[model samples]
Target chain A: MKTPVYISHPGLVTPLGLGVQQNFTEITNGNIAIQKHSRTDIAKEPFYAAMVSEAAINEAFKSHGAISEYTKLEKMMLLSALETLDNSEVKISDKTLLIVATTKGNIDVLDKDSAFNSERAYLPNLAKTLGDFLGVTATPVVISNACVSGILAVAVAKRLISSGGYDNALILSGDLVSRFTLSGFQSFQAISDLPCKPYSKYRNGITLGEAASSVFVSTIKPTQFAVQVLGDGSCNDANHISGPSRTGEGLFKSVQDAMKEAKIDAHEVDFISAHGTATIYNDEMEAIAFNRAALHGSLLHSLKGIFGHTLGASGLLETVIALEMMKQELILPSTGFDTLGVSKPLAIVETIKHQPINILLKTASGFGGCNTAVVFKKVS
Target chain B: MRNGALFAEIDAANFEGFLKQLYVMLDCKYPKFFKMDTLSKLAFMGAELLLSEISENSSEHKRTALVFSNRSSSLETDRKHQEAISSHGEQYPSPAVFVYTLPNIGVGEVAIRHKLQTENAFFVFETFEPEFLQKYTVSLLNENKCDQVLCGWVEVDGNERHGFFYVVGRNGKWKHSAATIKNFFEHD
Candidate 1:
């Protein structure tokens, strides 16, 4: 209980805007990142994606110095992590544990005829590459549990720091949104022609996006930050390998467990960061889950509207965005929302602003029925 | 609570012995679900043996959750799934073979048998990272989404399977501890 894991600082690079300050201000102003996807020839499917500008990615690598070929997904990782380290004024070293969260590390590189070794798809190799880039040879632990990877990474880093294994742990999450994911999601038919609209009526499918974020979690008790990770829960639906449960039963238990862990009631949550992918089933299931859990947040939204669905990066990426939202005193509007979809009468953030963030519930679900929820309270 | 673990080892010679060991463990339950019919079934068999009586109850369909990780992600199933697509045209592959493509789906099958309408998640790592295993397990436990977590490392190669499980508790608020392998692989 003495482990004061404070989010000293956060860094992010996404389609919305690069740099933590830029994104934070935009999030406060309720800016959205929806844009038509670049290069639509492969499947040629009509869809929108919140794509990061190549100029921003190039600038990130330049600032980090020449990234070696061995470092898979280093481009995105360095961009976000460096931003965090710079913002937090923390130095990276052997003493700092670099915990990376990702699903596909470098599968994108392997797909193309790249010069680097294609075998970086494995876990340890990918970890080493990331650690090497940070000038820390200490083994990086990569958590690859489909979409809920951010909370998964947080869980891992929290244990290490709280257990006195490391002085500081960097929770970095990103996805190298590859042709594989696009093709796979396309095959599953989970993509929407229009931008994804979560939790509202006339909601379409999800639009995929990419993000890399770094959060400096330390055992320091700071009285100023807006939020802290009070509790977290993750469970496998065990219902279907590829599809989510019809009842959202797994998500219910996860929320219940997280609340029990946090020692709070459902009514205490001021806002809920739902995993509203805008898919017909995913949205319906979440709507059903909220009603069954009897959980209501004063204001609710899915950052997927702003960042698209960053897949594995969605959990932490959205969580990081939520923290920034807390700092900015805003509850972001759910972008791409048109009308109400489910009968739950839940307050889905459809317009451009909701305010005064205090206690928030964040949830994310993935393939293999992986569902996770984490509670963050404003650390005043 | 120091739980006494039952470890049953099986090789070519103790194949029948393994079956008998499983039978005794099942406690008069129907033996058909213990589908140790082939070399491909060792993980299913070994995991079944490890769970002993806990897995054979009437609540086998949905009440139970499967949490497993491995280096070899269904090599046997992958070869067969590929063969079906290759032989019977790419579009018309066997649904039975195509279904087990993910390493975590076996848990769903076990849940379908148990009625475990709870949280089930699968982790894929190079070798089991102790920090990842302990933290992830504790998170699920602390959340109270899962009553008993069957966290383990299960490996299968040819006719051999080596796997272990530790049924741990999250209710104690062991949220963020860098638990050692003893905490993860050892119970009691």
Candidate 2:
């Protein structure tokens, strides 16, 4: 029999709040964090984004280390990972692996007036900084596959631990809403003018968000609220460089493979945490993929409406929230969703439904035509 | 260049020119080759050289995975995107340049070329960690995730470029181990 991996101690630092419980509370209370930001330094015109409060991050980071010494993304990652470390019995050692996931780390360092050296923009250096902060002896592995980096980190951790390469894995994922990403998204004309309404006909585009989330995966199970990493699949659309597949071919195959490995059928999945960025093509693509996987009737929700699109952090942050929902037996509504917009039908959670979520599917798709689906089961 | 015999060499003035010369020598007909950044071009060429030797069965292609690592993490293309939006330049970032900012686009390019939709991951490290790569790839094969894996270190930063790619399968002549992989990464 293969070794089973268990996940616990979810850590989060998002615009809603710090720590998993705080963010969960905010989401449960119908709070949305995406708002108008008129920062001239990041963009020429005002844009809507979910930004973590600098003051809050500094205040919470005071007990950890010097605030100014670390970059903004570093501070978020450090705080989130420290939460998981503080709560879990797992220790950072040679036997433990650290995986850092992000699209752009310390990207602000490339700005003309940045305080840090430009070399900090390199992902390996950024990961090493986090590893050094946490006193990890083994070389940290970094994943930078666009938005799927966060959830893909979980899948990587599961594989590494199952391979007996490590006793425990601490997965930390973070990204920033900096001038680089904001300008890039603006260039694509993909930034939503309003808070994104995923799967709604009136939805315009994605609302960029920034946050960091961490989770610990190990063979040892926590005393309470532990979830088993059943199976995972990541596949490329192999069709486009930047756009998702029009037919949702990659996502369909990913979900099918993941479920096949989990030895479960579509009817067994109680809920799905979807990657609904509210863009027209993305939502439509997801609808088709879910329908193709025979998951049209599965209860689904997108966390983007609450936290916006956290980029690298979105997948893990949303997964963390899904775990909490499983424990609480409450399925949060897909905020900002009104009418079904996609061609196929999706059982979008329109209201809070208190139901036992045994098996859940978490999926994320991103640039480079990458899609990842991971199946998790609540350990009773 | 087969078996390190140096069968061909191109005397070009610049890196791009050298890549173009190599493309012509290989007689590649793919029109999309011209649009890729330096990193993608290098990865595509390396993959072409390695994958061309494999069987042409389309069914086997779905069982092939690509695991790549790099040091720079698309910084060369990122520099261009940054410059386009910088105050000293045009201040208009092109979506075409912006799309190639992630390192995995190269992996995506190769996947599109070979129609391999199995598994893909791009890792960044300070240097090539052969042990980690070997362990990760072996686990994937052992777990029945894929039948074959294209693993390598593809790094490109401005004028510096290094690509080492090899296919790992159950029936390879050489044993798939860290030491052997390291030997190829260093000597080959």
Candidate 3:
């Protein structure tokens, strides 16, 4: 028999707070942090984003001990890794395997006017820097598959841990609102004016956000409260990269496959963390998919209203927040959820409620019809 | 905790020619009636040979996985997505071209054609993940997500394209040939 991979530790850095503990404290109380950018080159259209202030980030690094000058992207990764190790009470040693996921891993370095002209690209160098900081022996596996990069990073770590190739694995996924992504979204007109109202009637578009979350996976069982990643399946939509399938068949299949793998009944899921980008077709397609999955009555929420869309980091960060919320036995309120807009709205979680949380279906969809849903259950 | 697993090999030189040989092998295995297109040629060819025996089956093929990794952004479609929005006067951007912008959509193309919806992932890195294949396969199998997970390299270096994959399952028909399993890329 093969070993089962479990999430031994988790850490997150978002608009809410820094480190795993602070993020959890905010999530449980339903503290939403969609703040205005004050000023930017981007239009006032959807100026709201879940921005991790520079001060908080600096403080996080100070808490970690020392810092370096690789790049902000590398710093985000290192900070999250430190928080994860601290929360898990694990040491950063030469034996650990660190996996880094980002679509634009050190792509920000390209904006430095050096990568374009110079042969010194930062991605290859950034991974080495992150690995060196953690004192990891194995070279970090850097994955950058569009939006699914971070989610796939977790999936890859899960696979590695299950194979017992490594005793402990860390997954760090982050993406900021760079001119590349920010402009791309603007080019596609996928941006919204207000903080995205995921399932609200007359919802317009998505607000880009930045986030980084890290989690540790291991074969050792947890002695205390932990969320068991029962099952998850990632697949390409094959429909269209930009336009989701009208049928939501691929998304539907992902949820179905995950439940099947986890040996879970669809109805057993208590809450759904949707990839609610607030786009017209995306939300519509999601509603169709959830209804088809018979998840009509389950509590559903898209924290994008509070955190905005963090792209690659959104899924991992959201999953971490969801698991943290489980610890407090409290569910977060879905922001901008005034009226139910979805054709088949699965009970949109409107207000924060304290309850006996058990199972959660966390899902995300991105470019390439890449949709993934993982069933996490509170280990009994 | 790793389970019994192995690898398969594909020569990554002159991808088009390699794909042609792959097509013949796949056509022989499945005998499909549809004519193939250049767009689906490379991906379909790789997916076909990777799961030669299982590709012919139409039912419950989910247990047979399809995983690929590559760094070359889909330049073919990437260029097309760029060209279409610029050229088309009234038509919305060609969704078809915009679709393949991601390297992993190749996995979707194969999954839909083979109807193998079991377990799949598109991994991207600067270079080969070296040992992630066997490691990931064991995890998926142990988790009972797939009967046998397939994984390999799928990239377009230049005018050339390359990809390789093999199914991994525990069938005791053959002996535990550690030598063969270890030397797959060399001889298989």
Candidate 4:
């Protein structure tokens, strides 16, 4: 029998707040962190986004004292990982692996006014720096598959542990809202003028955000809360580079594969944490995919409204939030979603409710037509 | 395993001509080839040369996975995208250039070309590690997550571009092992 991987102690630093408890409180309270910002460094026009404050980041690092030069993004990643590793028996030894997931790590370094070296912009270099900070002895792995990077990192970690390559894996997923990313999204006309209303009739586009979230994937069960990674799968749409597949082919297949691997029926999934970017095509495609997969009736929610689309960080961060929700046995409403928008109908959670969530499925779809689905079961 | 490999080192000045030469050599008619950025172009040409022999079947396509890695990620297109937006107050970002700024788009290009709806992953390492590549591929196969996998390193550094793509499956003359992959890249 293969070793089972359990997720434990997820650390999150988002615009919502630091750590899981604070973010969970805000999420359950139906509070949103997205706000309009006119940062000259990001864009000339005012863009609505969820941005982690520099004060919060500096405050998080103050207790650790100064280390050598580390960029803001690096500091965010380190702080989140440190929070997850604190008071844990897990050791950063050779048996432990590090997987850093991001779309554009340190892309802000590309700016002419930036002081950090351009080399730090490389994903592998960023991974190495994070590995060194954590004292990981093995070569760090970097996953940069657009928005799916974070959720896919968890899948990769689970597979590695199941394959007996490592006993534990530290998975950190993050991305910052920089001029580069903002410009790219604007170019695609996928940026929302207002807070994104995912799967809503009036939804326009995504509200970008920045965050760093960490989850420790290990074979050993934790003393506290944890979830078992039952199964995971990824598929490409083979359709478009930027737009989601019109037929939702990749996502449907990915969900089917994950369910098959988990040896469960669609009815077994108590709830779903979906990737609802609120873009017309993406949300519509997800609805089509979920319907086709027979998950249309499941209680589903997208956390994008609370934490605007966090790009690479969305997948893992959302998973972490789902874990907390599972422990609380509460289903948070899909904020910003009011009316059904897509062609196919979906059971978008519209009200916060205290309900038992035994098995939850997390799915993410991103640019380059990538889709990933991972199924997790609550530990009793 | 049924496998193929190709490599190209453009003179940097005539990179377009080199790509055109590859297009002619492969006898491919995909016009989208010219629209792709440099990184996608390299990956596209490599996939064409590597997967040219595999027959297309609906079920087989679903069983094949594309796993790739690189050192530069998408630096080539990133610089261009950055240039477009920051060009002396031009502030005009091209949607085309912005789309290719992510490294995994190369895998998307190949997936679109061949219609591969299988498991795909892209990793970034300082340098190519044969062991990681081989182990990951084998794990997928062992778990029955995939029946076949096309994986290797595709890198683009300035004027220099190199790609080593090979197919691994139950049927093939070349064995899918770390040493074999190392030998294939080392041979050229």
Best by TM-score: 2
Give candidate 4's root-mean-square deviation (CA, Å): 2.1
**lDDT (10s digit) by residue, model 1, range A1-380:** 43556665777878766677887777657676777755643234455777776666675577557645434366777777777767364556676877777766555544434556646655456666666767775556656667787776675565456556677788778875555556556656677878788876777688888888878776765556735667666666657656788888778877876777677888888889888898888888887777777875456778777788887788888778788778777667777677888767678776546467778888888765778887778878
Higher-TM-score candidate of 2 and 4: 2
- Model 3: how far residue A122 lies from native, Å: 6.8
Cα lDDT for residue A165, candidate 1: 65
Give the runs in model 2 whose Cα sits over 4 Å from its true position.
Answer: none
* DockQ ranking, high to low: 2, 4, 1, 3
lDDT of every model, 2 decimals: 0.65, 0.89, 0.67, 0.87
Q: Provide all candidates' interface root-mean-square deviations.
A: 4.3, 0.8, 4.2, 0.9
Instruction: Give the Cα-based TM-score of candidate 4 against the true structure.
Output: 0.96
Model 3 lDDT per residue over A287-309, tens place = 99999999888888888888888
User: Candidate 2: what's its TM-score on chain B?
Assistant: 0.93
When candidate 1 is compared with the true two-chain complex, its DockQ is 0.26
Q: What is the lDDT of residue A102 in candidate 2?
A: 93
lDDT tens digits by residue: candidate 4, A22-67: 9888876668889999898778778899999977788778777463
TM-score for all models, in order of appearance: 0.79, 0.98, 0.80, 0.96
Arranged by lDDT, best first:
2, 4, 3, 1
Off by over 4 Å in 1: A1-4, A25-31, A38-47, A67-72, A87-96, A163-166, B1-46, B55-67, B71-113, B117-126, B130-149, B155-188
On the 0 to 100 scale, the lDDT of residue A170 in model 2 is 90
